[model samples]
Target chain A: MTRVHDMGGRFGDGPVDPSPEPVFKEDWHARALAVTLAAGALGQWNLDTSRHARERLSPKDYARFSYYEKWISALADLLEENGVVTRDELMAGQGAGPSPLSGRKLRADAVAGALARGGPADRPVDSAPKFAPGDVVRTRRPARNAFVAGGHTRLPSYAAGAVGRILHHHGAHVLPDANAHGRGESPEHLYTVVFDAAELWGAPERAGDEVTCDLWQSYLEPA
Target chain B: MPHDHHDHDHAHAVLPPDPALRVKAIETILTQKGLIDPAALDEIIDTYENRIGPKNGALVVARAWTDPAFRAALLEDATAVVAELGFYGRQGEHIVAVENTPEQHNMVVCTLCSCYPWPLLGIPPGWYKSDAYRARAVREPRKVLAEFGVTLPGDTRVRVWDSTAELRYLVIPMRPEGTDGLNEDDLIPWVTRDSMIGTGLPGRPE
Candidate 1:
């Protein structure tokens, strides 16, 4: 579904302030990240699910929250949905005690190695790639009101219906649009498509500039 | 729905609007629930806040500048080359090194979300994740680069890598001239975080 997080070519954004920022602004920002990662080790949800939870936030809340705040809200929702904790427990600051899932926790010692060998997204597919490098392709424009329930997708709105040439074939990877809804990982051929800035924004001054997006085969159609 | 949110406080205090207080409450509850170990949480926090960061990526860039074989290997297979140097982890399962030269400038952005090379560069900079950068970086990169005090030559081409998927990119920024005499140790300090991300250039020899 189209959300505020799908911001790409839309205008009226504020000017960027290029300044060095601390890794964590407050003590809680660190906690938010760590708790999210630690709980994520539970294998209750995947990265795309956590991302869709944030995007599902009301535009008002999404705009109001700081970066880490967004993570906190999403983690809270994911925790509740996965039956790891209850809203009452959160309000009470203590659960009905730990559940059986509690025993499967990430220990302090494994943190370094676990993060180093991150979960790989490239899964092997049974079928051959549909398209290869140098193939021109177009992205599908979704029908209106498509994302009724589990409308999790990685295709940003700006690139929808845009035609571009593929520069590289990245092999089979998980398709997030399907995976976000508890749908099985539908591995698809992934390619990096190069679009001219002028093609995306229609600005004459952007003639010499180009933009590239890593897209899954499911999003593309032969042009 | 009243039960779904802690809005409208009872005789008890509702979760504070302060995010710190809210996160505190969630953590306490999650810990008590046994889903999160306090020690594990500490380790994760310590690692990002202190251990992993741009210095790791800077080391790779310095090696590419000093060693031709590493540069070729980095361009050929960044994920394997970086892992060889012990710099492989989350958000960096796959990496493609894009080189910047006088004829072409490259910048990286995740317009949809902040999908950065965290293992290589640590947490993304504030601007890289800001709404403005997410919207304008892909739409008008030259303009965005200009705001960052980067003025490319009129003939130079601009390339914006919007990595919305799992394949992360590290920009192999062109090494500044007159630094040929410097060793990799001397070159390490010249590579800034933004330089590796392609929003800026390497520091000139001093």
Candidate 2:
């Protein structure tokens, strides 16, 4: 469950490089962004599903590919998976037949409008929020089944099993774990959980430090 | 179309680098399939670069520094307040403005992935998306901030916002000292991208 992508607190990561460059380094990077967004606008998969497709890659491949390269790969995978584009079409860089979803094109003029009207994950739920602001809570220890399954999860590895206090109740939002799997939007209360550095990383690392995370109700319990 | 002239030397010389060629090939294929409009691609790129960038965020910070009412509105309902100024979309659909004061500072990071407020801040810088930052930010934020040349007072509390959900964070960096005479327009230049992200402070006027 804890993949290389989830490297929150564990060390050995090299020093942060402060190189300044334009958003797209190469031409393909821009194309990668465009193609991914275009494909995504067709409504074949949600954002979480797109993210999971990239996370599902082998660690070796994930490490080797640049950020846009990962997106391009994921786009290709999703195209084939959704029957929008075929594997042979991707390999040959040409369509073998008419696109399956030819009618679902996002026009050039609609780009800005579509992005501005983002798909908000918030959904109405009947149950009231369990925790309020200032309530002490502890992060649930990540279950072995979910971790070993290697499915999409919003709970970062570093925050799991950590104790925190609720800073705010963010109302009900779609659970990303379920959304990624095509499960219904099992909406839940989202809260801003504030953890002391001492609680998360232990002593010497303490001192005037706190980490706040937007956690779902399922990830927390009363401390 | 160019692939037809496949003479070995011409192929080697005329072909772009691997990534460029790969992207070109994909673009051409998608265009042929009628999946993506080239004009739309250009529009998206233009929107991010020219229309929506850190300047929009700088303006918001500048206004917040000068107008208490706007600041209150931002802290209370960031999404609506920012949209009032015409900066709302995509990653910025839900935003919460966290203020940095004399006693406390705020920083933001997406531990799981590169989640940034594109409508306000444009694309995130390379360092924000780096593995080093993702790991160290929540663990040793002081050290990371120091690396960004932002050494705070020993007693100043550092609050790191890990963006794990839909709500994005924008750090309303503390106004620098000695800028009492500067108007809102003049103060816009002081608000840097890193300042909004809480990695560094706004530039103090000399």
Candidate 3:
């Protein structure tokens, strides 16, 4: 059985220092330590509490990997279990070996298996598009400190109630998630949302400056 | 699917990478004797800082302090307009200037991820992305600032801006009046990198 979890070692509760000053000077050891810590945060995805979450993973791997390494590991595990790839193949250092998996037409099932196996080179197109360019939108502000369900969303806590306009639409990208329900997420449109200074800071009384931001699809709803 | 069991209101899409040429490029770079190292340094580079980090922001901030109107434009749409000064580059894309005024002060955070104005500021300082900084920066910004040795008057509201991929931030520190006739080129020295990051304000002539 895979190890379910470890205490996340240290630094789990929060930052060790509440008032730690920004180190203006560069330090390699600090960067190494930070990169190591970042790996741990990503590792927690394996132990996610959702029903759709993945099972016990190797603690050794968890403790030693980088952020990207963790992502590659989780993805590799999911794909193998789903018959997307064979153990020998992955270990043999053979990639999913360039598409067209056994002459199967690329579609929902194939793409799904490929994603589980690894991922399709070109991401599948999203069927449902919530908002379009020039749409007036408001990012939903859920009650603070409440744990919402599902994927790792790009929506920031501070931007919850903020309103803005959709400037441009960027096609779908990865939905950083591990929940079972979220496993099927496909590429969707990303929007560049522009907000006026007044709306965010209650009118920049002096210069009346404006601020704009880029937001992924899931973060907005029609105002 | 009318009365859905799940909230389909939000959807997720995972875009796979192009494994062909991209990986080859990454592999070549990684295999290079002394190119880029998440660990070791390439001899050609003194430290990663000069090649890609804070020095970039420091240069811009230094220039802004010297030039008043340019500083004004930078405070405006830093991403779109700052190019006029020939300081445009990759990392500073979508820059927004947060002003630290007598009435209020401003700071920045990338709570969700380490999104920063890399072109202008260079690489983000490690502490900026710490969980401690993320949680405390907003809840107790005044306290956080004080720790950085920036004690603000109670009257000044310290605003904290969280940077995301969609937007980046730069800080507009108050100009020190003592350096009255200093031209833009001469004024660059006073605008330290920290001032742009909103950690410390520019010091007045001693």
Candidate 4:
């Protein structure tokens, strides 16, 4: 009864394997893709200009909070600032009854119902394979700290310039990089690549030591 | 999987197949209602997935598993050493790694916006992603764990890691029951995704 995109759905039923070597991209396009993802981490989109709803909090407060908290806080701040909802209204929990314009409930209904009914989209969910099991690739490192929320990001900096190979083509997943552009981007290929510890963080006496990362196609390149 | 709590009301609840579509829907709703500024949402999503997502946490988990001294170091100052690993996911800047002992168990949840220890646990489990897990984990954790097939005896005290301002916490689950005589290479297999989340114990196939 699980949806294809459900958590832990992409990997095969067998024990998850860790063998695709990391792929390294050589061109600017590959690098740009990496930059987009890194920059997207900072939330500077091509067209995104709206400010957050909460503004009175400390800068330290914003950085210390969880990602979703930041979203909620920002939304609240923005809503109040733009006069969409006032402090009194929100604090009072007024006009908070689900807005009719809200499509979450409706969309959730339609999609869940269709998926439940065994619609075409509900066919045994399978991850479309991309990049064969042994394709070598590399990660791109782009300078993306120029925007707001500059530099302090989640994408591992050690992954920059690291090379490995595609061990498994998990499936397409939402590309946060494009979403950061505020362009409403869709999911892209997700892969698990094995990087030699030597290549990523200098040599360890144990030459075979390595790490497997679930990387988006955008972060990969031909090695 | 607990039927007692999940009634038929969820039958009509639509689960978006595409994560992006789901986010889009949230974005659209927020935008239409002017609940959030478009730019801010962009930043929020950006940080959630990129800045505070699971990838960052995976590295920390892997490192803790490998480095004993680092593991001790993490237990002492998880926030600083986790940063030394070069990963600081959203809400990850402040970190606290809690060890799960034979007597006590640990789990994490953000009753708010999926507040997770992404720098250590990666993306949340599906159950963790749901409102039920988030709301219930904080209030009635014992009930929620029972729902997840995790039952703690009354004698055992389950510590629910509520990620917060000064620090976010991750449960370094007990190494599986029968992992003795196993090397790190072989030991990794016992590390089930669930173990990383602290809901289940790691176990080896007989």
Which has the greatest lDDT? 1
lDDT of 1 by residue, A124-160 (tens): 8789988988889998685111333436677778888
- Where does candidate 1 stray beyond 4 Å? A143-150, B1-15, B204-206
Worst 10 residues of 4 chain B by lDDT: B3-12
Lowest lDDT block of 10, candidate 2 chain B: B1-10
What lDDT tens digits, residue by residue, belong to model 3 across residues A1-223?
A: 0121212111233542434333334233333322222222222222122212221234444345433334344444443444444454444334434332323322222222221222211245736567777889997674121223433345554456788888655455444332223354444555667665456545342233333445656667788
Two-way TM-score contest, 2 vs 4, winner: 2
RMSD in angstroms, all models?
A: 3.1, 5.9, 12.4, 20.4
Which regions of candidate 3 deviate over 4 angstroms? A1-149, A157-223, B1-47, B84-91, B204-206
TM-score of each: 0.94, 0.93, 0.52, 0.40
What would the per-residue lDDT of candidate 4 be over residues B1-206, giving only the tens digit for each residue? Answer: 11111212221112232323323433444444533344533333343344544445444555566679988998878877876765554435456677777676766654323445554554454456444554445334455555556665555555554431124566676765545566666665565555556666666734
Model 2: pairs clashing at backbone N, Cα or C within 3 Å: none
Q: What is candidate 1's lDDT per residue for B45-129, written digit by digit as tens?
A: 8888889998999899999998999999999999999998888898889999999988888899998779999888998888998
TM-score of chain B of 4: 0.65
TM-score of chain A of 1: 0.94
Task: Give the lDDT of residue A196 in candidate 2.
Answer: 88
Arranged by lDDT with the best first, the candidates are 1, 2, 3, 4
lDDT of 2: 0.80
